[model samples]
Target: MKTFDHLSVIGLREWIGLPELGIDRVRAKVDSGAKTSALHASDIVTFYRDGETWVRFKAHTGTRRHPRDVECEARLVSFRRVRSSNGQLQERHVIRTDLVLGDQRWPVDFTLTCRESMRYRVLLGCSAMLDGQLVINPGQRFVQGFPQTDRTLRG
Candidate 1:
């Protein structure tokens, strides 16, 4: 077995468990083609929370129903127009938060968007995969499953 001091530039797409958020087996795509990571969300509404910039959006954590729509909020850090895979540029709201992957955890900037068509719910891009923090195993799936704890900490 080989031990890695730092993640290789290839394994960023492997399955990551966000146990703190009760998200398990979320298939993410590591895309160097994008500048900001994207999470599948719906019914996105921007609002003010505690007199601070915030946004409320729905998230699906690879489940059928029950607690399907998750309302998440984060400080409005910035918004930028990013070109999509199909060459259609769209403006997206970016938020910074802590992401846990395998034995590694770090702050990541995620762009909020309605990704109803994309196969994978989460798209980990270059901006998030920087600093050799992740190693994507293209031939692997669910490197680790998230714990079944509904610790929904608001971002």
Candidate 2:
């Protein structure tokens, strides 16, 4: 047996927080196969803020039966042409924001796209786990538990 003492172990599905976007507890699906993380966003609009491009969109954060919508705005990182899971290419709006998982918090880039049919609102891809801080346990779920609201964990 091997131990990754320096890395935190998380399950396939975990509760995450996007503090910058006012998202406190959104379920995220950890996908090691994907290179970029994605957020379920709709009604995406771009505007100028201080001469820089910014994006505003509505995020669906809840389950299908009990839907929750959060209107969010973030600075546009770039437009990326990414291939979807179904082998379709599409241009997506990219934004960088802080992601809070359990006691750890860090900046993670997420591509904005409509994922109305997906179960999870946020997709945690390989890029988000590339810092060598996370190791996923495919057989488990919510290993890190829900993110705390404490200010100290906001880092």
Candidate 3:
């Protein structure tokens, strides 16, 4: 396989974390075609805090089958109308948080929604890929390796 030494080559799926959001291990479907990543959030509620918007939600942080829920709170980035895979438009609460993937780390925005029926709780969309830094191998997984630590050492 051709290599781009500067790029982190990942698989169709990988494990990532959102420690800032209290999600230690979330299986993410790396979907390049998706514009904005999504999080499997339930019981979402909006509230005001220090003149800023905040949201409280429960998300599945572990595997789909052996799921573990994390109660999370984050500053609301915005409220957006997002189109679902089935082409239905829905209003969603968006929040920004740190994404821990393998040896690298970055901040990403996630649209909150109930993804109980989906295979994965998180969807790593192109926006979160951060300027084409990811090269996906369609047949592989954990290309960056499952983060050995619940939270990565990387900043």
Model 2: CA > 4 A from native: 151-155
Across residues 37-147, which tens digit of lDDT does each residue of candidate 3 receive? 999999998999999999999987766668788888999999999899989999999999988888677889999988888898899999888654888889998787765
Candidate 1 residue spans exceeding 4 A from truth: 1-4, 8-12, 17-25, 63-67, 144-155
Candidate 3 vs. true structure, TM-score: 0.89
TM-score of each: 0.75, 0.94, 0.89
Which candidate wins on lDDT? 2
Q: lDDT of each structure?
A: 0.66, 0.91, 0.85
Clash pairs detected, candidate 2? none
In candidate 1, the residue pairs with backbone N, CA or C atoms under 3 Å apart (3 or more residues apart, or in different chains) clash, namely 10-136, 11-135, 11-136, 12-135, 12-136
lDDT of 2 by residue, 79-118 (tens): 9999998899999999999999998889999999988898
**For model 3, where is the 10-residue window of minimal lDDT?**
146-155
Off by over 4 Å in 3: 1-3, 148-155
How far in Å is the alpha carbon of 22 misplaced in model 3?
Answer: 1.6
For model 2 the TM-score comes to: 0.94
Which stretch of 10 consecutive residues in model 2 shows the poorest summed lDDT?
146-155
User: Which candidate do you rate higher for TM-score, 1 or 2?
Assistant: 2
Error of 3 at 57 (Å): 0.4
Cand. 1 Cα-lDDT: 0.66
lDDT of candidate 1 over 26-58, digit per residue (tens):
667778777788877777778887888877777
